[model samples]
Target: MVRQILPISALLLGSALLLFAGGMNVLILPMRGTFEGFSAASLGLLGSGWAVGYVLGCVFMARLVARVGHIRSFSVMAAFAAIAVLLSLLILTPWAWVPLRALSGFCFAGAAMIVESWLGERAEPQSRGRIFGIYTMVNLAASTAGQLVLTLGDTTGIVFFVLPAIFYCLALVPTAISSSASPRPLARVSLDLRALWRNSPVAVFAVFCIGISNGAFGTLSAVYANEVGLHLTAVALFASLPVLAGALSQVPIGLVSDRMDRRLVLVLVAVLALVADLAFIFLRPDGRLENLVMASVFGAAIYAMYPIIIAHANDHAAEGSAIQVSGGLLMVFGLGSIAGPMAAGYSMAAFGQTGLFVTSAVAHVLIILFGAIRMSMRAPVHEAEKAAFVTVPQGRMATPETHVLAASPEEAEEIIAAEEDRLAEEGTGPAHEAAAAATAAVAAATERPPRVSEEEP
Candidate 1:
């Protein structure tokens, strides 16, 4: 793995810089908007806007990458991200920041997809898993570092906004100037809700609800922290600790899911989330340490739910359809993410800081009720047939390209053909064919994709 990462360390640095900027921007916007006297309700719309733009990028950016090639596409996306960050400073209103935040989301998704495609080009089959593990670590650490860095200085100034813009430009340099080959056309997905529902109703419902809860807290924690009179450091920690806790807790949660019925694991996690919710509502702790502790539990349970749900769906998914299953669920998660913050924002308007968890508790209640109903009606997939669970690096911003980058060569070959047929119907052209075909050909011949048609100069 070390040897594999050595050649691609430059790209890893790019990932680090890009996500570091992203991490800063995600936290910066809400906190800054709050300082500027934006209401919790308006601030909450920022996350919704971002989710909307990200979903749009995931659905459409492949054609853009396919048209122009990776480097040019990446440069354009990075430039737009930097522009968006700077523009936020100029505009400085909730209404303006909301759409600018959306623009940043679109750019982040496209740029991140291009980076993952570059990494996918270089990963050897035997080393793919380890390389992506390193890549995921870089992304998570960089983003967390970016968020923590905010605690070091005042975020009310122009410098905070400039910081992310600087890193956004820096992020593109190492990869743009590298002597590496172009990767395949970026992966794309068309949402097939019926197919996803047929495969696993529990997975579909659980992920959407998880999206709501995760989105609510992820977006509004800093707002809640500010409202509660915590230090700036606590605010950053409030926003970040749950994500880190979620990432770590997934390991044991995944182990349990793989061994037993995954929905049972979902119920267990949701129950924990509920427990955290009740603690916050009733405990009403005014101390910083106490808030962090309960927030960590909330993070652990809520953050871990998506992967378990995805793994459960994979167990019921027909063979060779894992990518589509994940992609479809990703779309569902996006929609739920959009709704979560809006609901939490309104809840905050009515209920104060506690409204954030009220939104999430509602989501968890639905998941628990739905999981029970589904388990009652269906027998569990046998342990022998279950797909081994994998931790999704950043559940919030994971793109279709993330699955493409991480899957083993054999797993890549398992893509369902229905996606390709649908893309053809949209006229993305033959080069926009199945990611399976692209991955298979790349593995069999050259790892670099041969553009089947003329690409934009």
Candidate 2:
């Protein structure tokens, strides 16, 4: 394992650096804005701008990489991102920061695509799964670490902003200086909404709801924390604990989804999320511990939904169309993301801090009602034919390349073959189907507890 990872350790480091910077950047902005007396509505707009840019980036950035090459494109994007952070620090008004946040999101998606593209080509087939697993872990840890960094000092300060900007630039040194040659043009997002709906209407509808619920919380958790009077330390915990809980929960959640109809699991999880939503709204946990507990439960249930939705969609996908299904759902999720923060912001504006969950609660109610009805309407996909579930590191932003790296081994071979077909067809066919076969999803699919074996790192 050590020998295999050593060759591409630099790429892993670069990914971690990027996440580290991004982790701080995402949380700090809302916290600082709240401190500066920015309204919940403005903060929600910030999330909207980011979601819009992220969707655009995932859809379009691959083309930019094709035209200008990975290294150059990545460097330019990173430079722009760092510049945007500094610019945001200088221009504190909500109006100016919105576009700047969008720019950061665009650059972040492009840069992440470039990094994942590099990892995709460089990884040998023998080690692809393990390498990707490590990459996922490193990035997730970095993101969590970045959020935790807030506990060390006042989160609403210039120093935190400066620190993230520095980390963003530092992220480039590994890949920029590596000897590995650039790979093929990054995977493009080819969205076939009608086809996706045809494949799984439940996935289409559920992901948009997932997008809204998760997107609102992802953007407004800090805002909610501040309004509820948690100290900065508690606020940091509020932000980070949900992610960790979600990561741990996906393993068991994936296993359960694999055993029975995933739609059933989807409904169950939605029910769980709805419960959390109500808990936040009514229980009104004033104590930091109660708030943290609810946040973790909320995150766990909400974050686990995407994997099941994607897996369920691919179960019905035509041969070699996993990428399209996953990509399409991702795009739909992005759209939901665009709406989530804005709607949640308005809700909080009208109601109170708990209004963040009110928006999420509505989404869950739709999910539950729709999921239960869908299950009764359609027979479950046979477990044998279903694409294996893979837990994704996807809460903040997930791009096409991220999906590519997340594909399972069986799916990986299919993707490479599909890539060949894509080339043979003169680039006129559907783009690569980089179906996400991520870490926890695979383990759950196989119904095995995690062990340091050949398949896992």
- The number of clashing residue pairs in each candidate reads 0, 6
Q: In model 1, which runs have C-alpha deviations exceeding 4 angstroms? A: 414-441, 445-457
Question: What shift in Å separates residue 88 of candidate 1 from its native position after superposition?
Answer: 0.7
Worst ten in a row by lDDT for model 1:
448-457
**Per-residue lDDT of candidate 1, residues 370-428 (tens digit):** 99999999999999999868788753568988887777666653432333344445555
Give each model a TM-score: 0.93, 0.91
Candidate with top lDDT is: 1
Error of 1 at 71 (Å): 0.6
Which segments of model 2 are wrong by more than 4 Å? 417-457
